[model samples]
Target chain A: MTFTLFDNEERMAGRAEAALRDLDFGSDEARAAYSELLDAYRKSLREQRRMMRLGDRLQEQLSTVNQELVRRRAEAERALQQLRDAQDSLIQAEKLASLGGLVAGIAHEINTPIGITVTAASILADQVAGLRRQFQAGTLARSDFEEFMTTADEASRLVLSNANRAVMLIQSFKQVAVDQTTADRRVFELKPYLSEVLTSLSPRLRRAGHRVVVECDEGLEVDGYPGALFQVLTNLVMNALQHAFEAGKTGTIRIRARLFDADTVELRFTDDGNGIAAADQGRIFDPFFTTKRGAGGSGLGLHIVFNLIVGTLNGSIAVQSQPGEGTTFIIGFPRVAPARPVAV
Target chain B: MNIHDISRAPTDRSPEIQFDPDACSLSISGASFPEDGAAFYGPVLSTLDEILKALDQRCVTVRIALNYFNSSSAKALMNLFLMLDDAAQAGNQVIVNWFHAADDDTMKEFGEEFAEDVRFVRFNVIPTAVTS
Candidate 1:
């Protein structure tokens, strides 16, 4: 018969007594042996009771430790979530700072064309007043009249052209700036939209003595977030202007776009400047990884570019560079992007 | 009477078992939580019984070092100690060394409890830096 020592003493004793009684023991020595066996069994029962008490206490201590571990894990998770929220706000601030820079750059660009237009209009008004006086006094010779006409013609032409240039600048700036700020999603012609982005960035390019060459086919269109694409292109151009060329040196930045497949379009941005070093190339897109940390690099330029193209635009980007040759960032994305999930 | 030696390998749920008839020594180590305690310990116990029966006032050593064991294994262990106690009563030298980790109070207490149950055999509950 199998019995745990946890069974009550009286029950166990009765079982042992019954077993001994059933056994054929013909001598007193055999009975004494049976009595010794009963004693061992009772001692084992007491041992089991003590072991049960010890096990219960151990189990209680283990439960407390497990609860402590669970609490620690939850605390770690909350800390991690806080870190993520802080990072997201920092990225937002960076985006707004870039947009502010764009606004300042466009304002500076519009000033020159508008200034020339105002100067030409004033000069035309002064010439008209001089011509009126001559006509009233009857001292208007054929040569004087002809000279006045010539001056008027030149001044009006200058005013018209300069005024139109100002209008064009404002138009392109408005489209690009609004798209970037609002993050609008729409179907847009790739060629004209790219030129508009380039126009908005022309002041920075001119100041840096760098030229951008755009080679995109006419009538090619993308059905995606134009604003996100604008941010991506702006960040890329800004990154090249900041790092690709040395100060006071000129470089050519080429942007070429074409249909990679029926569903995808590939855009390659190449710069003919000092290429990135081998060790720095891989970390360029990492946040806060910058060679110009103290001067002006927030290190989020390429990181923002990466997030925009990959996260917002649902695209892929890769870079190929040689230390002395140049750098090329090749980006490929679907012509029709998938819808983004609504953020909570 | 010939008593064969017993050697059983440890698994995820059971401890290793090694019995040497010539030396009259048995060592069980590692964790023991087998699904069926009787099935796992039946053959080993029978072999141990044979060895104890064949001994004539001979000495035997048993080493038990388990990190964790379930209720059923504990019961089997109790049975084993009872058999050793029977041999010691028959005028054979029996030494049982129970090894536990120094920090493991539960196992240490278990060893102490097992020692109290056996009146004849030398049950030594030893605390070590590690349990094997």
Candidate 2:
């Protein structure tokens, strides 16, 4: 409002002197008021400059902080991606390890029959050698020959039957093992596939004195990955065997399957054994949270089951259990599972 | 009498186990995933036992280089390391060298775990470049 007061100090002082010489102020009081106005205007200008400097400093600090935050966010994202990759690889490794255990089980099963065959074959070989020596010496008797023939026949039968059994076991195992290792989607009948998985698990079941009674409707076909289904079923059955029952405790597992609707199917797995505690039921699906630590429990079985059902199959599962009572798992999945599985 | 050297070829399911008493060294390499883990590692364990018994405080090095192994094989490895630890405690210099791929964090972590379990044995975990 007063341009003279805003001029440089030398110019303002000259203007004040000129005004006084020209008698511009009407009285002494008026001159004093003009001087005071100049002082206030100079003070206000100083304060404005100081505020501008402060604003610049604050802006610089904010920019530095923003840059640091962006860098940290990028680093955190990289770390998170690395963690995801590690988790994926570990899950796959666990699956391979489970398959390795299955292979070991089948091998042990086959070894038994092979051992019997080896013993029987050796006995037959010895009897034939004796017969050859007796015939060569021209001292072979009819009773001796008859006895040797009987022994050979019995040994042959034993060898053949046991060898045949081993072959059958291998064949059945081959199908289940192949299905387990591969994840290619294919249409398959539900009931028979369930039976195959159960049969493959027979050795574990028998060892634990557990009986599985499957009640599936006939001709219930599903369009999905049998391999995934096999893994899901295997995990459920093994979980029950490991966690549900106590040592030397005979338990019965009932598996029932039916069509939930046109596009979905429902499967119920129940066991009459020790149930999970209420506190632990929620965290049961968490990876590596096992109550049986140091007792040969990997604690990944149920986690893997959960991943397969929800992540791979695009399905849902629920568990209902109470302490001292039986535990039941209900799973619902689309008849035709998703074409591509969701990566973890 | 000294323990004889053992040389086993690698199979699809098991690793190659080579133990040379003359060299005072044993090396197991490749994927150690056997159908019958106990049966597969049984002879190796027994041979090591015999060598340790006859070692007479001689320094022995164990080289374990596995790309993959199952849980059961992990148990077997634990037992093997324990045996070596015992031998070391008995005044035998036992050195265990665990080799893992540079990018294999899980195997490296496993090596670290095994190292924690053995006190007397000189545990060395070395990361090497991954071969094609």
Candidate 3:
């Protein structure tokens, strides 16, 4: 079609139709057709510009609103997180204070058995020296030598028992401290660790007359902080001893270390004392929660134990305790080269 | 609104951040160490993986401005940088702009730690006004 639409002096092109699309106008016209079109078109453009201005203002307001919401939410979240952190820190601090209070008691409890063990060993050494001198004399007989050997064995037995007793006492405290304090890590042998820990706890065991059986893992290798694990074992063993054995009675504490996984070792400390109460089981890991609260007990023992195993050791601890039966603490830790170097 | 990126500030003790897929730029600013940093940042990196595919332009610049991250988060950030390196090496122009304040030595060291791992991409430690 050869239609020259732009030839006319109409500055507004197809103006009537444009307004209709913008706001739904009707066919009814009030003024001259061209004037109607122009006025409507201009008015529509003016309205659109006004609406755009309003929309922009609304968008700006919305942005400010959104930013305000975000800022408030962030502040609220930060405050909440800080609240949680403060609570956790307070718990840790409380645990530390209590541990400090009990440390002396633990040390004292451990020293007695150890001192006796040393004294017994010293006496035994003297007796062995006397027997040696007697044997050197020409009049000394084979029967006498045999009797001396037997007596020496008895003294050795006494020394060994006392030594172990002293060791257990120290170990309990060590375990409690190790769990509470974070330290550097290193590679260590398992058998020695088990013995050392048991030695430290021996005094407490003796006081309670709890016999501890050790089934050490042969050639076991560990690649984390030893002190932390030491603390964990100490707490578990002593916990078994003091709670498992009735006052004025005796009990048995069994410590078994074995390979749990390709790169993990599990230590199981079990005792035949009456098991953890069903009520106390759930609250055991919660800091400062303890049934033996009045007995100079720093209720942070298990909580510290759990933290050591899970936090410092990067492992797990499980307790299987039953009322009137016994309690067992099973801990598993990586036994090979750690993925990262531990701060030792 | 679609700013889908988060990072640990060089000196701040905060959490790690994730990038929004819809934004042209992603930023991570804060201290990171929420207990198990590996567990937290693991999924966030995975989330950024899907969003990176939707970008049509051949070039993507990801800025990492972290103040301080724990060892665990440090490992996670390494993994993340490696991921970006992979994407950048595979015909997608990826640029990693690591921003650090001039005074924060720790953040600078951390940024260099990742830069050491990256093979194909260019990593720049932009020293700006970083308040500790």
Tens digit per residue, CA lDDT, model 1, A23-67: 778888989999998999788767866685566456556657988
The candidate maximizing TM-score is 1
TM-score of each: 0.60, 0.58, 0.41
List candidate 1 stretches off by more than 4 Å.
Answer: A1-82, A341-344, B1-132
Pairwise DockQ winner, candidates 1 and 3: 1
Q: On residues B44-126, what C-alpha lDDT tens digit does candidate 2 reach at each position?
A: 67667667876676899999999987655776788788888889999999999999999999999999999999999999999
**Of the candidates shown, which would achieve the greatest DockQ relative to the real structure?**
1
- Model 2 clash pairs are none
Ranking by TM-score: 1, 2, 3
Least lDDT summed over 10 consecutive residues: which range in candidate 1 chain B? B1-10
B1-132 in candidate 3: lDDT tens per residue?
132433333423345454544444556766664444435665566656565655555676777766655555555566567767777767677788988889988788777877888997788888889555
Model 2 lDDT per residue over A252-277, tens place: 99999989899999999999999999
What ordering of candidates by lDDT runs from best to worst? Answer: 1, 2, 3
lDDT of 3 at A323: 93
Better of 2 and 3 by lDDT: 2
